[model samples]
Every structure is written in structure tokens, then in C-alpha cells.
Target: MTPTVISPASPVELLHYMITYQRYPTTLLICSSDDEFRAAIAEELKGQIPEEQLQQEPDEFGEVIIDHPLAALPIFRRVVARHLRVLFVPSVIHLRAILSVFSQADSPIPPPPEEDSENTKQGARPRPPSLFAYGFLELHRDSSEWSAQGLSSSASMFVAAARRSGFNPVMVEPKAAGGLANFEHVLREHAPILSGGARRDEGWQGRTVEVRRVFDRWFRFQTGQWDIKWPEDNAS
Candidate 1:
């Protein structure tokens, strides 16, 4: 199928195209920041998300600069990719996160504006020494070595890399939020296609596998094909 970029004057038009499109399979709406998207979606599609569920607070990294349209793109891509369909629209953050290699001690991307206060309170956190820094710092410290294949133990590293690139990742939740285990549960339920990691020496491929599964499950859950273990994952 052809991959053509669609541009419209507003987020409503974007969502309209996404909901109506038959060929694309999955649609992603991305913007530079989240507030802009949230405002647009609220204006255009008032009830897409409930008022109480939206995350009003910024993440420690200040990545909340992304809006709903842009945030939705990665989730949409993850879902569509799992269905073996080409992703529609492009989220700068999602694209950069998945495409870039991991490194430890990589410099931290500027925090989102909403997170400045948190940063001040936390003081200056040293940047990871490598591209896999997030992984090393959050998920797997010792095993933080960058592996271009498999689901490397450092999911945080991938998230951090995206943050470093000035992109906010819109996953169901932060691993610290107990989302990883929830994601694991979702993966087990769906019976997703998992590549053999150690055998193929494709740890990075495994990472993509996990990401795709999470997206697939999330989309399915949204469409009523599966039940979400926790509603919070779908809320914000």
C-alpha cells in the first residue's frame, strides 16, 4: 500500500481521517507537544478521554510537552504494526525512540516544561553514560549494555532515549507505575509472536516484539477484543 502523509487544519480532521480510513489499518496523530493535542482533541472530540483520567502532572523528565494527537501516534503505530499493517502518521518521539540505538550515559533530553519544578526538587540527575542509560538507571543496571537485538532488560533506556530526543513516549504507563508487569500479563493473554532472542542474537528485535505486543493488546483492549487488567493504563 502507499504511505502518504495527511495534513489537515485541525486535530478533528486528523481523527476523522483515522476513524474513517480503511487502508491504513492503524492511524497515529502526533504533534510537538501534548497540551496542544489535548486542547485540540477536547475541542474537536470532547469525550474521547474522561476528564478525571488525564494526567495533569508532568513526568520527572518533563516529557508531557506532547499532546493527545501526538501521544496517540505511538500507541496507534504499535497497534497497527502488530496487525502487520504499516503505521499511519508519524510521531516524532515514537519514530526517534524506536529508530535510535541505545547508549548509557547519553545526555538527558531537556525536561518538559511541566516538569521543571520536579527537576529542581530532585536536583540535577546525572545523565546516563551511554545510550542505554535509561535501561541501566531504571530497569537493568549491570546488564545495561546496548544490544541491538532482543527485549533488552532496559525498557527505561528506550523511553529515556526518546525523551533525550525531545519526544514523549505514550505507553500505557511508566514501568514504575507497575505497567511493565501489566504489560507482561497482556502479552501472555494475547499469545503474541515472540522472536527467539538468545538464539538469534536479536535482543533489539525482542524489544520491538514486546513493544508491538503491548500496542496490539492495547488496541484490542480498546476495541473490546480483550479486557484491560487495569483501567488506569488506558486512562492517560
Candidate 2:
């Protein structure tokens, strides 16, 4: 199935929709070559979303960190078990590496043999469940049509990998002509509403409907019923 491209009208609208309409287990994972953008997003989401809902890759304890992407399989399995809904990947390179791991049809090597005798007294570890209705964030340098095409190619690769790994993936890229400043502005504007105890505007509901339409398109695209065209360029 061809992947559908989504270009949100604005960052504020996207955040509003995510916070208001997204289902439970709504965790966002941020990964980047540097932590600047991730830090910015975390700062913006401070009062808006609960601190527990946002998580960083590698984590504070360095438990999930891995030198090779394939080594992260256990971590990915755990994240899926936890039912994380959103993953904000800022680094294109990191995103590609993760996708490569998922693209594998099956494990290349056999599982380690179970311990004998004494180990039989202990129970085996539980496995992670399948992921569903998950979202991924992609940040680009500009909003040009050329950039959009490049993003489409990346999204296609991501969706294909996710499907192969037994996940239903939806990619979202919020429009911000003014770049980071614009994103900050939008988040600030909606901070009050996101913090709670305020009536939601009718316009926010309208935007939610619009965003839902985008997700519907993604769902339809996954079925291969739609004649969506994928770019020749494939993300490695």
C-alpha cells in the first residue's frame, strides 16, 4: 500500500487535535542528532501535557540506549507493550536506522536456548503486544514542495516498515512557515486551553475534524484501494 502524506495547517492545530482526540497511551518519543528541537517541544508541552506522557530515547537511566539499531528491538518491544501512541523523531538519520530494523521480515538469528534445571523454576518473560493507531513526527528544514516530496518518500519507507513490523502508522508534519519560532508561538497560544479548565473553541473542533480526515486518508491508503503514488527515492 502507498503511504499518504499529511501536511497539517499549523502546529497549534495539530497539538490541539492530538491532545483532545488521541486515544489513551499517548506517549511521544523524541530522537535527534541533537536535543535542541526535542527540548523545545518538551518545554512547550510542559503544562499542556502531563510530564509522564513525554519520554526521551536512550532514557535517563541509559537502559534503552543501544550502539546498533537492531539492539533496540527489545526496547521497541517494551514501548509497544506500553502502547506509546506518538513518537517524535527529529533526526532523519535516526529515523532511517529504526526503519531499517523494522524492515526485516524476521529475526536473522535463532533465539538463545533456554537455561536448564534451576532456571525452570523461574517463569519466562512476557512478550510485547502489537501496536495500533500510532503517530510519528517528522521535522524538516523548510516547507517547499521539494521538501514535501522528500518527506513523502521518507514517510512511505516508514509506513512500509511499520506495517512489516505489525504496526498501524500515521505520519504528521505540522506547517510552520516561520520555522521554530512559529511552532513556539502556536504552542504558547494554546497552552492555556491545553492546561485544562477552559472551554474549547468551536474552531478547535473544526480543526479536529480536518485532522481526522487526514487520518482517514492514511487508513484508506494502507488498504491499497487508493492509487496513491510513491516517489522513486527510497529512504535508507
Candidate 3:
């Protein structure tokens, strides 16, 4: 029988989506050596979506999967400039698109190695749409005693960990440009809950974060409500 997992919070929901979508837009899984934890995550995911959609990869990256339908979705890729190493910017979707584009390359793309604690400090980078759209999936041990306070505290830590994982971790607030702030605010507000400790920081501090909001029009277009209107982004 397929395992069933329950997620009482939105963070879990986001993780389910991220894990499920891995098979689609791009099939890449990032997991640790813990099988039980991975199984728990997969079970929790079964609660969110159907079992047929998930496929696992048995290799160094561990049991990973991508949604079959999203196989046709185009991906984007961006290089992490050494100067912007610690910044968590851009949405995960945007990163996914970027990575998908880069995955086309025949070479094996490498993830950033674990950062040395002594050389780290707070930093900022441009936020992309994917990160905002997907939010983040922070895994924590069930044995760890976590309260509401811990969830809030861990948000920052998860972002930091994402940076170490080679993704931008932008500090989004309730208000910011490109609807970036709004998207993150909504995601976190609607984010699924999970076990964790206190957050490392309260919020972010940055003046110039190139953020863009995905307006209702984009959704409308996505849903076939109207034709798609893409902005002329020279940066890409």
C-alpha cells in the first residue's frame, strides 16, 4: 500500500509540491542519507497528490523524483556569481527554469559545497519568481521539540541552508517590488507547518533587490484566461 502522510501546515504543502513537481518542470531531487525521513516526506506527499505522479531516482542524490507531466516544461538556469554566493534571491520556479535550461548542457552541474561558518555573513541578491512561487522546504527531525516560535525562527535558517545548497535565499517582507515581497508574504502566510527550532533572524535588510511580481494576468494566461504577455527581460 502507498504510504499516507499528513501535513498540518502550509510548509508541508509546499514541500509536497516541490517534491512532486521535481518530476515535471525538472526531475531533480535533493535529499539526505536518512531513509526514514525521506519516506516520511514521501508519505506526507502522498497525502497532497497521487502516487502515480512521483518517481524516485536511486543514486548519489538519493531517492528523488519528478512529476511526469511537467517533463515538457522548460527550465531556466543561472550561474551563481562568486560575489552573490550567500544571497537568496529569485523564486524557485525561476531557478527551476534557469536550471532546466542549464541541465540541457551535457556536463554534470555541481551544487555549492557546504559553506564554512567562519567565512559567512548576511548578504542580499536579486529574488526570482521561482523562489517566491515555491517558497522553501525545511526538513527537521520529528524528535526535535519545536513550537510555533521555532517555526518562525527556522524560516531564516532554512533560507540560509538553501543558499548553501546553491539557491538564492531572498529575505522577503509584506511589501516589496515585482510583487516579490507580496508573493513571499503570501506563501509564508499560507505556508504549511513543520517541526523546527527558533528562526535565526527576524527579517531582511536590503535596499536594492531586483524583484518582479507575477500578476493576476500571468495566472490568467497560465489558466488560459487570456494570452500570455511576457516582459522583455534583457537580463536573461
Residue lDDT tens for model 2, 114-171 = 4234246667532321222222333333212113233444456666666676454544
lDDT of 1 by residue, 129-200 (tens): 211111111121112222222233224444455455543323221122113344344333221133233323
Rate residue 219 of model 3 by lDDT. 19
lDDT of each: 0.33, 0.38, 0.30
Candidate 3: minimum summed lDDT over ten consecutive residues — where? 217-226
Say which prediction, candidate 2 or candidate 3, comes out ahead on TM-score.
2
Q: Residue 158 CA error for candidate 1 (Å)?
A: 18
Predicted structure 2: lDDT: 0.38
CA RMSD of each candidate after superposition: 17.7, 16.7, 17.0
In candidate 3, stretches whose alpha carbon ends up further than 4 angstroms from where it belongs are 1-33, 37-108, 111-141, 160-236
lDDT ranking, best first = 2, 1, 3
lDDT measured at residue 158 in model 2 versus the true structure, 0 to 100? 64
> Which parts of model 1 are misplaced by more than 4 Å?
23-25, 44-94, 99-236
Q: State model 1's lDDT.
A: 0.33
Candidate ranking under TM-score, highest first, comes to 2, 3, 1
Reference-based TM-score of each model: 0.22, 0.35, 0.23
